[model samples]
Target: MTTFTFHGGAGEIGGNMLLIDSPGSRFFLDFGMSFKRHGEYFSEFLQPRTSNALGDFLNLDLIPDIEGLYRNDFLSHNKMKTSEEPAFDGILISHAHLDHLGYVNLLHEKAHVYASSVTKGIAEALDELGSGSKDDFVKTTKSFSYYENKKGEISRIRNCRDPEIKYSQREYPLTVDRGEFEVGSASVQIFPVDHSIIGASGFIAHAGGRSIGYTGDFRNHGSRPELTRAFVENMASSDLDILFIEGTNIDEEKGMSETDVGNEISRLITEAEGRHVFASFPVRDTFRLLSFYTAARNAGRKLAVNFRQAFLLDKLDSNKALERGKDIIPSHDEGLSVYIKKREYGLIGEDVEEEEKARDYDKKERPYVGIDNQICWKDVRDNPGEYVLFLDNYSVQELVDIQPVEGSIYIKSQCEPFDAEMELDWGRIENWLDRFGLQVKRAHASGHMSGGEIAEVIKTIEPKLVVPMHTQRPVLFSDLCDCEVLIPEKGKSYEF
Candidate 1:
């Protein structure tokens, strides 16, 4: 018997953790963070205690308590029993979205991680650019261990700053080729799928003489609808015993495509000529970024992205050939510019005293400070119509410096507020826009298949059992599909 357990994503829309136990193999699908679950205990000001390590996550049921599935440093330091060998075979990550790959660094070191090359590259870039107390994704920093100082006193080893403590790089086998790979007793195959973010994939695992198909998150309305269609066609002939599908948009009947968003943005930019335009969207959604880039090019304006997006674009361009045959816009494109916001002390450029601006920005950001395509607040303010500034709510403070002209455009190209905290943030953004006399417009597309599209996919696949996940309305699957629908309860085990 093959047992399937729902540890997180069953009753929610983002936190996805599925444990698959076969006769001789045991592994997890994805170890993601559930926004709904995390919001219950932690907020913006209140965060999980780093001193407690995994204690907060474990106690709050944010992560499963399965043995031999967590990091060694955390387990031993927290006084939890340590395992000699990793309990699970491996983790197959579908994409780089936070909801799908947030908690991967917390897993056991010996367990190999399987993901696409683009996903690995994104993880590496994020880890390199991330500050605060974040551990690395490609190479995790060792934590909570102790060592003897020169004075013969015991002291806890800090992350990577200490020369003796090295970053741990685990075995992350690239699945970009979409070839068959062995995971314990199971054989797995990967397929590229369309989603809001790049490097998204679907998986099919054959173990214990049973075939299971899992869709991490997909939509047929994005720029690459053909990718989703190919996955559906392949699954239709695979004789799948069970299908695990995302139902995020299972209650909605319609969806907008990325091309549509691009057209609307072009029209808006054309109409807002001779004035500045600013937009906000998920930075990782390279397709949406490309939409804005194309729109800016058509309107004779450069798209100015923050340092994070510029860094990510450079990384993606370096690994474009490694991706699943998708071409992303190059970071060095003439129509693209890196926006360098004034850091601490409000100092930028060479004219400022070096000593005063030394502590303003991180070393990673210093390299692009004076680059040819870089733009600062003064540059944008002097030539407002020459650039389309990309600024999210977190970066809205720059508005005070740039001071966008009246009738300037502000495009919200992401999802609407899903929770109260987000609603409050949106309200704050509105206040900023209103204060600057900016005109706000929403031109975004969702990253999931709509109810009608999902129904069509279900009918085409024709699996024996349909299991809905990554959704709040799981019961709706029964009405949408002709096959047997199992609405899994959180933390329960089901067998086929």
Candidate 2:
């Protein structure tokens, strides 16, 4: 028997988790947090207490109620029953986006996690650059052997893999590959798809004689439009029984391309006279970073990024893991500079001792490697027009220090804010620009296929059953495609 369970990513934009149960295999498609559900209960200051983490989320239905899929420690802490073994064998991550891979820390220890090689490298880099908490992906360990157990006993039992900190790099479960692989009875073929992210992929999963073509999140307008085209063509020939696809931009028709955004940015920077440029984009969109990097170079200006982005770029570049266009990696380059915030006590603070620096990566020099070509806000303020700054929402606060004069430019090189909360954030961003005297400009390309584009893709593949996911209007897919559309609800199971 083959069954599909919608654990998440239903009638929403993010938080994609699903269960694929076949006679041979049981696994999850993603393990992410739903922003819509989370915002209803908690805020920045009103977060759930660590003592009641699982309880808080469970009470709100923010996470699933599966038994053997979650970590034993979390369930035990919440007074919930935990299975002695994991119910699922693994989780196949589509990409490194937070909406797709954020809740990896909640998985059972025995779960074997898989992603593309680039996705794994990006996840490791993000973990090194992200805040250290129990929810983090990479575990920090000083010793390679035994760890201090909860009971403070010297036990040498080794049976689990994750949810808790791995404590050692050797125990990290980041087994990544391309092409066909099996997780128990289920057979899966991973095809790289073009999305806003670098390692986004589509899956062709087969179990119990039923095949599912799942497009996690895809688009056809970026540096690699050909990739998506090929994926669509290939999946069309797969003769899948079910086609599961993301409809993130299904309501829209026309869309912009990455080349278009780069040309616009290049024009804006070249025409500006003595005005500094500020651009906003997703933190991990390496290609977008490179596009802005190219724009800055065209205008004869260096691109200044925050320490975290520099860490990601430096980690990816130093490892030489970026496959397609390794030369586009923007670290330790003349055109790139790390913007070190002049903080008194943060990670990049001048007062942080050499001995007390971060110890996540195997390399001893990782803590301060990317901060070598550091530039303070004052450096930018002194020579405003000499650099183009990348300051998305999180780093926008730094504008108070730089203090740009009137007529400076601000380019929002990302999608327009979608939800009410994001709309509020967009307003706040405008207020900041108003206060700082920066002229606002809009230029961006989406990471999802539009309605017309996806309709064509659906027609090409022409599967027996079509299920819309990663979109608010799944029912509308029936009108968009020629095949039978099934709008799967959250937590519902469908049999094939």
Candidate 3:
């Protein structure tokens, strides 16, 4: 018997938690946060109290009220039941996107965590960088071999966890990607897929005379389109009983291919005169970063990245698999400069002496050494035409310092508004551009399969039952696909 339930991400775009049970053991495909769940009760200032861990989540229903799967320490701290027995086998992560893996922090330490080594590495790096306030959660561990650090060679990561822990091999299971693995009665195959973010994957689960395939989040128009095709071809022979897929962009406008997006941005940057080029895309989108780098290089300008991006590139290089594929990873000399925000010691608008600023800056080793590839707002302001700046929303204030001249270019190279909050933010972004007199040009691409493209993927898989997930418009898929469509409802269990 095989049963699966959707705790979240059914009829939504983000939070994805799926629990699967075979007769002998149980496993989870993802334990990501649900935006719908988070938005319902909390606003910016109003958040769950830190003192109540499981109490807030379980009572507020952010996390499912499951037994034994939560961390014993956290549950006990919250005065909730902390079962000694294990609830399920393990968790298999599809990608490093927070919507896909944000809730992993709340899991019991004993429950196995599985993902591609690159994903684990990136997750750890993000944790180290302290993004999204995940410092308290996100316990990701990986085994790497540093045969010799004397030469400063980055260690090679071996594998991604397959949701089982064998203490005999080491204290923890090797965090590596695997081809075939077993969890009780179910045997599965993990395969890589193309995505905007690095280390995205899909998996095939086989058990109880039924075969199912799960795609975490994938796109056929990424830099590695072949990988997506390979995933489909690899599973074609299985003749799947059911297929669970994501539809993040199903109800929205179809996106452009990465190459086309690159071309559009390149043309914009190349044609701009007497002004700087500024663009903002999701920082984790590895290919988008490379595209902007290439565009800057082709335009005879250097790409300036923020402190966080520089840190990410260095961490990525430490992983052998990802490092080898990089044509240009951010560094001081690789047409990349680390944008160091001018430090202010006193309250807002309170000016300090040049000596104070210089002395305080030289005293700190954090955010990379200032002497190496570090550019301040003044340097960029002076040399506007020589640099292309990668700006995230948080760093939007740097525009006041850069003081982009009239006719300067700003490309918003990400998808359009998906929600009210996003539309509000978009308006603020345009307002910032208007305030600075920067010319706005929008050139963006999505990181998911379109309705037409998804229809073709269904044609290839040929599953008997097709369940639409990670989408708001699952009904549209029925018209797009030829297979029997199943619209998953939240917390509903289904049998195959």
* Local distance difference test values of all predictions, in order: 0.85, 0.77, 0.76
- Write the residue-wise lDDT of candidate 1 on 343-457 in tens digits: 7777864476655565688888877776789888888888888999999877888888888887898998999999998899899999988999899898989999898899999
Residue-level lDDT of model 3, residues 62-81, one tens digit each, is 88888888866567666778
Residue pair clashes in candidate 1? none
TM-score of each: 0.95, 0.88, 0.88
Candidate 2: worst-modelled 10 consecutive residues by lDDT? 138-147
lDDT per residue for candidate 2 within 1-496, as digits (tens), equals 7888887899998899988888879988988888888888888778977666767887889888887877666677677897878897789889888788877866675567778777777878766655333444544322213455677665432422333544433123444444888878888888888888887888888888988888988988887788788888888888989998999888898678988988998999887757788888988888888888988988999888876787777666754435524324656788888776544344433345644433322352354433567676777888888888888777778888789867889988888877788899899989988988889888889998899998999999999999888999887798887788889999989998
What local lDDT does model 1 show for residue 94? Answer: 91
Can you list the residue pairs that collide in candidate 2? 24-185, 109-161, 109-162
Q: Give the TM-score of candidate 2.
A: 0.88
* Residue 17 error, candidate 3, Å: 0.7
Identify the runs in model 2 with alpha carbons over 4 angstroms from their true place: 131-133, 138-177, 318-321, 324-330, 345-372
RMSD (Cα, Å) of candidate 1?
A: 2.1
